[model samples]
Target: MTSTAIAIAAGGGGDVVAASVLAQRLRHRFDVVAIMSYSWDRLIVDPTPGPRGLGDFDGLTSHHELVAQVTVSTVLRGPGRSTLPPLAHYVGCPLLLMDPVGGVAGLAAQFGAASRVFGAQTLLVVDVGGDILAEGTEAGLRSPLADSMSLAAAVRSGLGLHLLVAGLGLDGELTPPELTSLLQRHGATEVAELGAADVTRFAEVWNWHPSEASGLLCVAADGWRGRVETQRDALIDITDDATIVYEVDAYGVAANSLAANLIATTSLADAEQRVRTRRGYSDIDIERDRVPALARHDEWTPAADTVGAIDRYAYAAANRGVNALTIRRVLELAGASGAGAATRLRELLKCERPHNMRPPLYLA
Candidate 1:
């Protein structure tokens, strides 16, 4: 068998997209590449708080009875939705499922099994944004559980984990300066930039996938600059750094993350509880509380009311200390959905994708 490299997208959706790029970047080093990712997605997609397990999906192919490969036909067992099936269909690679429901130890076992099954020696853990390096004390950190669990599990897997951080501040979780400081603390081993050609590999996915972070990364790789707004109206700077991927010492960075404390958790709940018990807040709890409110506020908004809707959502986000929300989210708040909402929003705002929002909306 040819040498295989396993690239695990620390989180799903955009991370998986980034992982695909990284795998291609490393093509010369390995004869084959296998992609892996968590099933966790935004509340708008999965409607769930945490990552889904193998049991939550159907039509998955068992891989050595250790992990399962997600296919285009794979569907969530319930009413929930996912980007995985569509990603599997578009990426045309071995999209493997990572069930974080088992927590860090369980995740470590899966990593070990996947490595052995694929006969891979080089293992990469890819995090789209640098939130994986958060110490859990950063003011902007909103999602840390999934990335931390990935870090903890990768380190515990005993497979020599190589941690890659792409789109440093694209997620709007850790700012560029904050992420840079953390990388300095961990001592990044390599820093390389991706160009326009690198992004074209999966640009088609950006058309429909709501992964603003990954989209921003691709835009940056394509040489776009300036601030772009995302969920909560947070404006991310799409600088050259956004296109640069950093490979840092996994163990060193893990020590600075909540990963060090989560290596023993038995379930995603246990992991979330541990974070809340120690940090006083959890993203899962925040989601559990926010989704119900979003579901109840579904009133159709007319064109004349769109401005008023934007003002209301922007004001709320400001009060929460978040800078901005994506145009898509603002439209969603205006009771917009389906395919044409984005086009209508662009027409209303007179702006285009990756450039619509120039200056920051909610200034800090």
Candidate 2:
């Protein structure tokens, strides 16, 4: 095993929370090198194949930039109408953000260089749900682009790697049965149970930011089972196996046809286009393209129409299971306009946690 371990959330957001739990565990054995995720988000404007590092995400005009790291030390207010659960609010000492630029293969080189800087001998890429192993045709699959892209990059990264699928089926992308079948078919073996300790540890960070997957995983570890409403599909069944953690060689699991199909993909847009084409999706990223946040912008004034679209997006973002890129689409659908529409939509949204909701007292 390598002394320095790099933990990457295969997908963004709450998936990082799962990775953080694993990193906490690894700290006892190895040098926890760094934790990172794609600058992309399924909830906000982050789609469009771009590189984010040093000069990134300052004001929301998306583009490719240098391979620098953005360290988040503060919990600035979140989007008021936001409904997505976070991965790590504690975000360790300083969470590192590794934007996926230069395509999958290029990203692998970036990983290799970073691994050297951090002295990482091993790389562990984690995804909360098992969809990272999906064939892409699965019915419940909605966001395979990011996971697949990361896996492809990691496989090509030339670093020691292990793939951990934590909180299987929690994302509701794959049914309970679909996940198990994939694992078995791909030669994945049960490494250990994420267990109550992992849940308890994660619960420390979850309360300040409730995670649909973490919330479900915590209770499920205790044998609680039922269904919960999701932004996408109606409900997902919570089986006792939700807490089980499985491990497989990165190459073996990435062999899935869905993921393999992405090996030749040149850019995020190309990968997304492939998944959508295979799935026959026309309006998938179309809405995202329309969303103002996903597009480039200037410091312009906000118009009433633009404000109206923003209000509508906040309401629909969590309810409709809209992808991060669709904010402009929401604005367009709601009749928002002007170059400032994107600027205004961003300026206006504010996240206010429910007063009745409580924070996790166990993290300490």
Candidate 3:
């Protein structure tokens, strides 16, 4: 087999998109590049909370002897859903499904197995925003479990690890200056910057990916400079730094982050418990509580005056500080759901100069 390199997305689907962009760049360094990504998606996209495991999926192909490759046809076994299948089909590379159900040791074993099977010399753990480097004190930090787990697992995996932080502050979890300070503390070096060509490779996928942070990365790469309004009315600035990817000291980051304390976690529950105990909250808890409440009132029917409804939703969202929303969220706000919702949303947004909005992302 040809020489291979693996890039691990440090979060969920958004990180997977970021990994794909980085993996494409890695193709120049290795004959083959594969991405390992978590199945955790936002509530709007998956509905089912938490990351899905290997057994949760239906059409996964065995990768070599150990890993499972998510294909275009893969689907969740039941109520759970996945964006990995569509992502696999479009990313144009082997997209491996990484189940973090077993926590750090399990993840480490998976990492080692993939490295051995593919003869990979180095593992690149990529985070879209710099939250993986956060020390759990940033005011904006919301999701840190997955990123910290990946960092700890990769450190224990015993592979030559390279840490990359891309699209700084795009996730709205950490600001550019915050991440830059963390990077500087860890002695991270600036690597390559992603250009339009890199964004173009995945632009079509962006139309339906429902990954806000990744979409922001592409928009930033496309030279859009302004404040990007996201979920909860949080604002992310589109700056030149969003285009750069930094390679940091892997061991130093692991040693300093919440990952260090989580290194021995043998189960996901244990890891979540550790994070909650330290940070006073966990992201899974937030998802678990929020998803059901939203289900109660998230449904919306397209009003007879569709334009008026769109305008109302836009105005309401902005008043709440949200000027941009993911396609899934847009569908929810419009009270549209099921198979025809996306098409219906396309029609609804058209009257609002949706051309300015990217697919999967509506610039409200």
* Residue-level error in angstroms, candidate 1, position 286: 1.1
lDDT of 3: 0.79
TM-score for candidate 3, residues paired by index: 0.90
lDDT at position 263, candidate 1: 93
Ranked candidates, highest lDDT first? 3, 1, 2
lDDT of 1 by residue, 1-364 (tens): 3346688888777888888877776666554357889888766556666778888988999986767999999998874577898898655478899988788998888988888887877678898878898988888888888888888998888886678888888888887688789989988856568888786867667545667777777777877676555666566666777777888889988887799889998888899998897678887888788777655443333466676566665666567655445544555556544334443554555432234342222222
Candidate 3 lDDT, 195-280, residue by residue in tens: 88887867787666667788888878877666556656567767898898888998998998899989999999999999999889
Q: In model 3, how large is the Cα lDDT of residue 290?
A: 76
TM-score of each: 0.85, 0.68, 0.90
The clash count for each model shown is 7, 13, 2
| Model 1 CA lDDT for position 163 | 85
Per-residue alpha-carbon lDDT of candidate 2 for residues 279-302, written as tens digits (9 for 90 to 100): 875223644554554344333454
Task: List the global CA lDDT of all models.
Answer: 0.74, 0.57, 0.79
Model 3: weakest 10-residue lDDT segment is: 335-344
Residue 153, candidate 2: alpha-carbon lDDT: 80
Find the candidate with the highest TM-score and give its number: 3
